[model samples]
Target: MNEHLKVLCSLTPCFYIKREDQASIIGGVIEFIKELQQFVQSLESKKQRKSLSPSPGPSPRAPFQLSTPQTENPKELGARCNSPFADVEAKLSGSNVILTTISRRIPAQIVKIINVLEKLSFEILHLNITSMEDTVLYSFVIKIGLECQLSVEELALEAQQSFCSDAVYVNDI
Candidate 1:
């Protein structure tokens, strides 16, 4: 029995059977395989969890921070035009205008801004948008026809007037 156990232990194909006890060999192999399977399953589960999770931190696309004073309500700013804290910039070169805005995240805000631009007869050339938890940033390049009379400053003022939030910042580049 001892010699047989040694032969079984020495078997190259069954390297897992390190013990010399014949009765416990199968049980040990079964236990080892089960442990291996469990470890693999845990690894797979971790991968799946990571893939399914939403971003744990700020998105890479977020461009800037939207900081508002704690004492002021964003909604109040939204009700009025030309917030003192609002920052706006507009650049016009020939018939092209470049505008960028950062503001608190408001639902349908982009649609409203697009509507304003269209009303002013600006043709959208390029648009880029990104959002963090509570803020949104937009960059737009637009072409105004020769017939359109709105200047870059006028357009920037209009956006500030429409958004009515101190958090809104519009700039041209």
Candidate 2:
């Protein structure tokens, strides 16, 4: 019995069967293989559909417009005028920071920001940028290594002073 058990363990086939129950085990193994094949085929079809889908591009619709209030408030007007360079917000989770920036779509702004993060010795885990008309939004997930010495507030302040002076607000999540 011990030798038989060893032989069964060494078998590389999907299903092992005792000599007394070969028929039932074989049937079960066949059913499992069939289901696995079907699952693989479904996954292949999903991949094909995703590959055929259209890539994201700028919208064909008209540019966004903010409605102006009829009442004359200088504060309101100023806020509206400066809406293009809004703010930067960062949220820290574990060693990862989620940074969001909304500002005017200056060319190479994304590249410049990435360079700053790399200079600070932070690893960028993910980055996404979206643009609508003149406005651009950036979302970045960055890993602050154990060697990083700067606190979250310091990092945010440095980012604002160095590259995003136009940002009117900066906050952590």
Candidate 3:
């Protein structure tokens, strides 16, 4: 039984790769982690959605407006790099809580946000920042895991707290 189990494990692709390229196996392991994380997240979201009956809240609409700032207090700082397109949005996909924002104020608000998320242990899946409507917009699609139960309130508060400096103005999405 032990030998059979060992043979089966060796036949698995990731295990084979692990045996072959232990050092460069980091990328494969990272991808495995991501897939596992996503699967767990989907299960969690399904459970959460099932536990509570759907509130008569609005149906999931296109470009669903998840949260917006209560106040718009713009702070001005001198000579920053502006990307000419900035808009931030976040969503809960399966178990992944994706947060994204955009800003045209130079040095790129998205770049600053990436730093903050890194500090907070959030894994970013995809990010797209480009110039639009004469304003720099940042859109981030993140994966929130069990470690980070990123609620809308917490995300909004974090956005307000971290990016509220004179460098980036957290706008309503």
Note the Cα lDDT for every prediction shown. 0.53, 0.52, 0.45
Tens digit of per-residue lDDT, candidate 1, span 1-173 = 67755654554224344454666676555534543453345345444644776866323232322232121223322111223222344554334665656555667778877888888888888776655555555657688765679755577767665555323333421
Residue 119, model 3: lDDT of 64
Score candidate 3 by TM-score against the native.
Answer: 0.41
After superposition, the stretches of candidate 3 with alpha carbons farther than 4 Å from their true spots are 1-87, 167-173
When summed lDDT is taken over every stretch of 10 residues in candidate 1, the lowest stretch is 76-85
User: How would you encode candidate 3's per-residue C-alpha lDDT over 48-81 as one tens digit per residue?
Assistant: 6446746532122213123443322233111111
User: Residue 57's C-alpha lDDT in candidate 2?
Assistant: 27
TM-score-superior candidate, 1 or 3: 1
Candidate 3, residue 46: the lDDT equals: 40
Tell me model 2's lDDT, rounded to 2 decimals. Answer: 0.52
Residues 1-173 of candidate 2 have per-residue lDDT tens digits of: 55654444444233323243545455445534543453345345444644775743222232222323232324322111112233454556445775656655667778778877888888998776656565566767789876788755555554544344433332421
- For candidate 1, give the lDDT of residue 2: 75
Model 2 misplaced stretches (Cα beyond 4 Å): 1-86, 164-173
Error of 2 at 144 (Å): 0.6
